[model samples]
Target: MANALSFTFIHVLCLLLHCSASSAQNVVFQPSFLTIHGPSMTALLYGFSSKITLNLQAIPSSNVTGSFVPPSCVPGVTQWILTSELIAKTAVQVKLRLNRSLRLCGNNETDTDCCVKPLCVLETLQLTACEGNTSQASLIIQVKIYALLGSGNMVFDNSTIIQNQVYRPLGDCPCDLTFNTCDLWCCCDKDCSTADFKLFRYRCLTGPFGGQFPDPEYQCSVQSTQNSPDWFPFLCVTSPPENNPYLGLFYQGNTMAPKPGISFGGSVSLAPALSNAYTEGSPILTIKDQYFTIPQTLNGHCVTNAPVAFLKNLDVRCVTSVQACPTEFPLQTIPEDLRAVVKNGIAVFVGNVVVDVTDQLATELNEFVTSSDIFGSSGLVCENVTLALDYNFHWKENGITGITLTRTVGSVTLKGNVSLTTRYSAMFLSGDIMSEPNSGNPGYQVGRPVIGGILNTSIGNDTVLIARSPMHLWKPVNSGICSSADVRPLLFGENSTSGCLIPVSRQNLTECSLLRNSVHSLQGALIEATLVARNGHPDALTLADWLNITYVTLNSSGVEDSNSSCADIPSHLHIYLWTLVSGFVDGIPQKDIKAVQISYSLSSWRLKCGGGDSAVCMDPAETQLLPITSSVTFIDIPLNTGPPKTRYQINFTEYDCNRNDVCWPELAFPITRFYTGESYSQALAKGLILVFFFIVASVLGNPWRQIRQIWNTI
Candidate 1:
C-alpha cells in the first residue's frame, strides 16, 4: 500500500508543474497576422499578451527611435495596467490614430495580460519602428499580443473600430478611397442600390474632377428687321467682339437708313446735270413752280416790285406824273397892271390895273354888288391876293349887298360916308378914309352888329372919324371894330365917341397924346405903343390930361381911411411912375423906394394909456413917424451903363415905443411888457399846487374806467 501511494503523489506533482509551464508559454503575438479574404490584401492586428510583453526598442543607431519599455503585471488581479508610453505608442501607430484606452484582462498567475473592467486590452498593437540606423529609411510596424482565458481561438475585434463605425467597403484599402476617385462614402462592390448609388454619384459629381457646366441660353445673337440693299444687317450678339467689324457695319447701316421712312431707289446719274442747271438759274428743284430771281438793285433804289405778288404776276403799272387840280375857276381875267391875284384857288394876272367884272357878275347891279363882283374887284386890285365870301351869298340880285374894295398902289379914298349894317359880315379896307361932300354920316360906321362880324381897317397914313350921333356908331354890343394906322392918329374926332383906335408911329413927335372923351361917353385906350418925349422935350400936357380920367374911389371897403382918395387920377397910369419914381422927377432909386407914407387921423383917447379913471392924454400930433425896415435886403442893382452894386440902406423904428418904463436905449423903439407882480418862486408854487390837485383828481376819478365807458358809449 505504501509503495502505490508514493507513486500517486509523484504523478500529481508532475502534472501541476507541467500545467504551470504551459500557462507561462502561452504568449500571444500582438497582432494575429490578418489576411484579408476578398478583393484586397492588406490587414491589421490589435491586442496584448503576457509571456511576451513587448519591449519596444529603438532601431539600431537612430536617435529619433526611442527605447522600448515593457508592460507590468498587477500583483493580485488578472489584468494589466499598460504604461502610458506603450498604450500611447499603440494608439499613435496607425495611419489614422485610434481614440481609445487599451486594456488587457484574463486569468494568469498574476495580473499579467488582462485589464480591469472599464479598461480594454488592445487586441492588435501597432507601433512605428524604424528600419535601420538612417533617418532616410522607411518606417516598419511592430505589433504585440496578449492571451485571453478562452478555449477558442483569440480574435482581435477592435472595440474602437466597432463602436465608432463608418460605412467603408469591406475589402478596399483606405488609401484607394481618395478625393480624386471616390467620395467619403465609397463602396467597393458595384451591386449598390439606387439610393446608395445616388449617394455615391452625388459624392463623385461634387468631387474635384467634375467640371462646371455652361449656361443654357448662351451664344444667342439678335438681328435687326430694318434691312435693305443699301443698308448692312445689324447683329446684337451675346459676346461682342473685341475688334468687331460688324459693329462698324451696324453704324454704317444706320447712316444709310437713319429712320423708318428712308428709301433707296434713287440714282446719282443726273447729279452733274442738275448742278449745271442750278448754276444756269434752272434748278431741278423749284418752290411753288416759280423760278427764283436774284435782286438787281440794293438799298436807295425804288422798288419796282412794291406788291410782292405783282413781281410774280408781272402786271403792275407805274406812276407817271403829279399835277394840281383846282376846284373853282376865277370869273374874269385880271388886268395887266393889276398885281398877281389868287382867287378861288386860281392865279390871276400879274400887274397893276383894275378890271371891270360887270358882265361876269352873278347878280344884277340893282343899286348893289354881289360877293362874286366884290371878289372880282379885289382880284383886280392886288397881286397874290385871295378873297372868299360866306356860303349864304346867292347868285342873284339880293346877294349884291356885301362888296369889297381893295387898293394896292395908289392912295384910295372913300368919297362917301359908308355905313355897314349886317349880321355875319366884315368890312376890310387898307386905304384912306374921307367924309363925303355934304354928307352928314361919318366914315365907315356900323350899328348894332350881330354874330360873326368884323370891321378891320389897316391904313398907311390916314385918320378915321367915328361919329357919336349914331349912338350905336362903331360900338356894337358884342362885335369888334379894330382900326390900325402906320402914320396919323386913328382918330375919334368930333361926333365920334366910345370906340377904340390904335395909332402906330415910326417918327418921334413932340406933345404926342391920344385924345379920348372929347365928346361925352367916349373912351379910348392904347396898348403896346410908346408915348415919348421928342428932342429931349418934356410932355407939354399934364399927365392927368394925357391919360383921361374922371373919378377915383379909395378904400371902398371902409377898412382904410376915405381921405386917402383922389379925384381925376390918370386913367392909364405908367407902371414905372406908380411903382417907383413919378415921371423920373422924384429921382429916387428903385432900391431905396421901399415903402410909401400916408397919414390917417387919430383921436387923442385912442393913443392914450392907462384906465379910464387916471388916463394920460396922447395927442394925434404927438404920433411919431417910425420907419420899419423890411427883412428883404437889397443885394445889388443892375444898371445899363455900369457894373452892379448894392445901393440901399434899411433901418427899423418901433411904433409903440412909450409903453414900457425901462427906457433901455439899446432896445430901439419897440418896448415889450413884462409881468410885474409875481415872483418866480410864487409861480412855481402855484404850478405845484395845480399839479398836486391834478394828480389827486386823476387818481380818484378812475380815468381809465371813464375812458372805457366813453368808448363803449360811442
Candidate 2:
C-alpha cells in the first residue's frame, strides 16, 4: 500500500509542475489611459497554487507620478515586502507614466520648487522562500499609445520566468518604448520615437482623408521632382496614340493599282438645236467604217473643190455718160536778166533789181552812194530814208594820218594835214581845195559841200599852226534845214571865228577838247585819242556825247618845284562812260581813291567830283550847255543815224537843276572829292582797332566780373 502512495505522489507532483509551467509561460496585462504623451498603467495578477509564495513589488514606471503606491495583497504587510503567496493571492499593479515627472533632490525640497521630477527605474518583483524551492511569474502587458485616442497601436511584452533560481525573460517591459506622430521628427534622419503616437510610421494621403478610400477613377497623382528618374512613366500611362488616314494598300512594299470603271457608249448624239447643220452633228467626214472620224474643216464649214461666188448673176443698173479729159493750161514764161520775172503766179525780179516785194519790203543796201549818177535829177526821194554808214571817209591824203572817219553821210572829204593809209579808204581827196558847182540847181552855192572826215593831226613844233575845224564850221542843225542851207565851206588856217578853223596860237589847248564836239551830231561816232596837257590846266578835256576810257596816265612830276601838283582833273561828267582806272593822280600822295568825293561851290554853282580810280573828267561849267526845265529829262543821242540794223541808245533821265535846294548839288566834282575827308587806310585801321578792343573787352570783362562776384560771395 505504501508503494502505491509513492507513485501517486510522484504523478501528482508531475501534474503540478506541468500546470505551473503552462501558467508562467505567458502573462497578459491590460493598460489604462493609453494616451500618446502620458504613461500607461498595466495590472498583472500571478496565477498559481495558493501554497506558493510571491513577492509584491513596484517597478519604476516610465512616466512616474510624484506619489506612487505598490501592489496590494489580501494579507497586507506593514512594511513593503514581496512574497510569492501575496503575488498569487492579489493582483500586482504597475502604474507606468510614460513620460514621468521626477523630483530633484537638493537644498530645495518642496514639490513646487523641485528642480526635476524623480525618474522611475524599470524593475521586477522577486519572491524567495528557502531559495531551493523557487518559481518565476511573468506578466506580458501590451500598451497602445496613439497621437489621439484610438489612433494606432503599440505592443510591449513584460513577461518573465524563473529557472534554476534565475529569471529568463523575453524582454524587459519595453522600457522607454515611445511613439511619435509629429511631422517635425518624421524626416529621414529624425528621431520619431519621441514624437506623438500618430506621427510614428504615418503616411500622408494625397487628398483629405474623410475615412473613405480614394476613387479608382480619380487617380492619386503624385507630384514628381525635377530630378526624379520615373518622371516620364506617368506621361506614357496617361496618353494614347492616334492613327493616320491617307494610306493606301501596298503589295510587296509597292502601291496597288486601282480598278477601272465602266464606259457605256462609243459616241453620244446631241440634238439638232445644239449642233451645226453643215457638220451633220459629226464635225468631221468619215471615209472608213470606223468609230472615229477625221475633221475635214474646222468651224463646221464645208470644204469646196472650186471657188464659191457669194453674189452671182444679178442685173445691175447703169448710167452712160462721157467725161472730158483735163486740158493743159498755158503758163506764163519768165525772162532772165530782165531784173523782174514772174513764174507760177509769183512776180519775181522783173528788171535788173531783185526786189523783195512782200507785204512790207525791207531793203538792205550794204554799199550805198549819193551822187547825181545814182540819184539822178530828182535825187533819191522817199517818205523817210535811213542811210547807215558804219565808218565814213573823205580827207586830203597829205595831212592827217591814221585817222578814221566813222559817220553816216552823203559825201566825204579830207583837208588840213589829214592823210589816208588804208588802200580801201572811202572817198579820199587831196589838198584843202574846194569843189566848184556842177549842173542842176543853178542858183545853189555848192562850193564843196561840207564833207565828213576824221583827222589825226599832231601839234607841230611851230608855235603857230592853223586848221579848219569841222565841228565849229557847220554845227549839226536840225534835219529841217538840210534842204535849204548849204553845208559850210571847208576851211584851213586861221580864217574867222565864225568859220571852221583852228588857230595856231591856240595849240596849247588839249586835243581832247578839240574833238569833243565832233560827236555831238548824235549820228554815231566812236573816237579814241591821247591828249597831253599841264596838270590842273583846265584845258585837258576828254569830251564826247559819250566817252568810255580804259586807262589814263598823268605825269604831274614834270611841274616845277612843288612837292605835288594837281595831276588829276577834279571835275568830270559821265554820260554813259564806264571808266576803270589804276589809281587817282592826286596832289596828296597819301590820298587813295577808295571812296567817291563831291565838292560844290554854291557861289559859282560849280561842282567837282572824283570816282575811285577812274580815268575820266568833266567840266562843271558845261552844265550851262544843258537845257533847263522843271521836269525830269532824257537826252536821246542817236548812237547811229541809220536803219534798224544800227544799235541806238539814250541816257538816264536827269533831274532838273534846282538852285534853291542844297541837297540837289551839281552832278560834277573833282576826282579827289570822293575822298575829301577820310583816308581809306585810316578808316580801316580805326575800324580794326575798335573791333579788337570790343572783342577783348567782351572776353576779359565778363569773367572778371564773375570772379569778383564769387569772391564777394565767399
Candidate 3:
C-alpha cells in the first residue's frame, strides 16, 4: 500500500511541474545569477508577480512576496521551515532566494573555493497534509523556474568584485605641512598637547583641503573601521583577476577580437603656420611655417630654438661664439611681411584692427665692433663682444600698429679666447610712454626691483617728468674692485648692506675735497631718479612720495673740512624707507605701497695709517684703497584697514595676541583646563580617596596568597 501511494504522489508532482512550465512564459535563467555550493543549487530569481499564490493545505500562507531577508541569509546554516499548527510561521520569506556561498563564478571548482560553480540539478518540493495525527495523506508539487537578472550590478553582479580602496581619511591634517614643527592654531598636530592648544582657541581651517575631521562615508573602506554597519565583512572589497568582460553560458562562443591598444610614441604636433598676422601667446613666425626664434639661456647655455612670445616684455643675456652671430642674431634679416606693412603703412591686425601712434620711431642697427678682422690670418680669433637687440612694439586696445627693431653691438678683444654675450630685449611702447609694470597695484610688493626716476623738465608740457629706472648698487666685476661695469638693483622691502674697495686717483698732495666730491657724485647718481609713485602718475606726487638725501660732513657740527686728510671723505650711504601695510586678512597679511617715505644719509670713517705714522699720508703721491658702502632699511607701518577676512573668530579676545606681546595670560590662554567642571584640589582629593580604598581592599583580600599558588602551579 505504501509503495503504490508513493508512485501516485510522484505522478501527481510530475503533472503539476508540466502544467506550471506550460502555463508560464518561456523564461530563460541568467547563468550569472545562478550558483551551486555543496549539495544544493540556488539562484537569485526575479520577474515573478508579487501577487503569485500557491494553494496548499499544510502551508497555505506560503506565497511569493517581496523581501530582503533571503539575500541577507547565511548559506548552509540558515534554513526555511513552516508548520500548520503554529499560528506564527517562520521561514526565509524572500522573492529572490539565493545561497550566497554558491556563487555563479565559472572559475570556482572546489567546495571551499568561492570562484567556481557547482553542477545544476532538478529540485522538487513535497507538501503533506496534517491528517489524524499520522502521515496517511500527502501531496507533491514541482515548479520550473528561471532566474531574471537586472541591468545594473546589484549584490550578485561580477563588476562589484574590483572596487577602489581608499587608504586613509581625506584631509586629516591640512595645517601640518612641515614635519615636527607645530603650526600655529592647528588642532590635529600630535605635538600640540592640551597646554599648547590652550594658547590658540581656533584651528587653521582654510582652502579645499581644510577640515577639523573627515566626514563619514557609505562604502566599505579604511574609514569603515571608524564608523560602519555590522555587516561590513560581507560587503568588504574584493580584487578579481583579469579575464573576459562578460561571463556565463550566454556569452560563450562569441569570439570577437580584442581591440588594439593605443601606442605611447605618436607623431609630434608641429607649430601652427603663420597666417596674416600673429596672435597673443602664439609663436612669432617670420614666414609661413617658419618660426622666428631667438637665443635663449637654458641651464646657463644658449639655445637658438626658443620662440618669442607676442607682446611679452623679456630681456635675455647669454654667452655664445662670435662666429655664430650672423645666424644666431634675430635682427640680421627682416621678414617680408614686416617690411610690406612698414612700407604700405598697413595696420597690422592681431584679431582686431590696429591704430598707429603719432610718434614715428626709427628702426636702426648700431654696431660698435672692433675695426680688426674677426677671422685673422693666424687662426680663428674670438672677443668679448656685447650684442644688444631691442624690439619695441607699439600696441593699443586693438592690436599692434607699429614695430621697431634697435640693435647695439659692442666688442672688446681680450688677451685669450673669450666668449661674446648676446643680449635680447622686447617691450611695448605707446608714443613717448613705455609700458612699465608696477611692483604693486596700490602698494609695493617685496622682491621686486625698486622703481626710481630722474626728475626732468619737459619743454612744453607742464607735467614734471622723471626718467624711470631701477635703483642700482655698486658691485665688483673683472677684478675685486668696484666700478660702473656691473651693478645690481635693490629689491623692494629688503634690507641689505653691501660695500666695496674703490681705488682713488692721487696726483701730488691733494686735499680731501676731490675724493669727497667724487664719492658724493657716484652715490648721488644712484638716487637721482627718486619719484616713488605709481606708474603713469609721476606728476601728481605728494610729500610722502619724495625721497631726499642728506650729506653728513666730517665734523660733529655737520661742516666739511677740506684741509683734513683723505680719511675725512664720505665712505658710506644709508637709505631709510617706510611702507604702510593694512591689517591681517584670513591669517595672511597683504602689503601695498600707499604712502612711501624715504631718506638717505652719508657718513665718513677714519683710515688706518701705515708704519703707525703719518709719513705715508704726508707723501706727495700715494695710492689708497677707499671703502664705499651702502645699506637699505625697510620699515612697515600698518594702516587702519586690511585685506578681506577668510574665516570667523572662534572666541574674541581682549587684545591681538598675534601682533602684540603685552597681552595678559588670561586672554592669550583662554582654555583653562581640559575639563572645566572640577578644580585642581577637588580632582586631587578624589584620586587620593580612590587610591586609599584600593589599597585597603588589596590588604583585606590577600591577593599575594593566590598569586603564590598560581605561580607554584605554573
lDDT of model 2, residue 629: 9
Candidate 3 deviant stretches above 4 angstroms: 1-215, 218-380, 383-386, 409-414, 417-422, 453-469, 480-483, 499-501, 534-564, 583-588, 593-622, 638-714
C-alpha TM-score for every candidate: 0.11, 0.11, 0.41
1 against 3, candidate with superior lDDT: 3
> After best superposition, candidate 3 residue 76: deviation in angstroms?
99
- Compose the digit string of candidate 3's lDDT tens values, residues 1-714: 665566556554644553344235322112222222122222211222323222222111122331111111111222223221110011111122223332334333455433231222124333222222322122332322222112113343233221222322333565676688776767677667778778875655553234343222333444455565444444444433211122221223233443331111122222222134444555654423455555676776767668766655666666544443343234243332223122111222112111121222222212222223446444332332235656676655434555565545333443234345456776866665676655644445677777776566663465555556667666543333565334667778888877677664334115566666777676666665555554222333343444443334445335554333444455666766566655445664556444344334445543346567564455535445667777787776656556754444324434445555776554413234433567866766766776686665554444755777789999
Q: Which candidate wins on TM-score?
A: 3
Q: Where's the lowest-lDDT run of ten residues in candidate 3? A: 84-93
- Report the lDDT tens digits of candidate 1 across residue range 1-714: 655555445534533443344334432222322311111111111222222232222222212332222221212221222221221111111122222222334445365433344222222222222213211111122222222223233444433222212221122233234444443344433344567656666454322123222222222333334532111122123663222222222122211212221111132111111111111111211112332221122253323212111101111111111112112212112433222111111011111111111112212221111122322332222122112111111111111111122321121111122111111111211122211111101111111110011112353344322111110223322122123211112211122223333221111011122211221122222221223111111222322112211222222222321221212212221111111122332453321111211111211111223466222222322321111110111122234434433332112223223454555553422221243356756655666776686665564455756877899999
For model 2, residues 1-714, the per-residue Cα lDDT tens digits are: 665566446544643453455355432222211221123332333333344443333333322232223232323222132221122222333333334222233555565532232322224322211112443342322222222211123233333332322222211121223444323422332333444435743653222121122222212233344433332333223321111111111112333344332211123211112111111112211112112111122243322111111111111111111122112110011112111211111111110101111111124322321122332343212221212212111122211111122222222121222111111112222233321212112111212221112223465553322222222133222221212112333221122221122111111123323222332221111112222111111111222211122233222333232111122221221111111222234432111011111121111111222454122123312311111101111132333456432132223223323223442334322222344457766655666776686666655555657878899999
The regions of model 2 sitting more than 4 angstroms off are 1-40, 57-107, 110-133, 139-714
Best by lDDT: 3
Q: Quick one: RMSD of model 1?
A: 67.5
lDDT ranking, high to low: 3, 2, 1
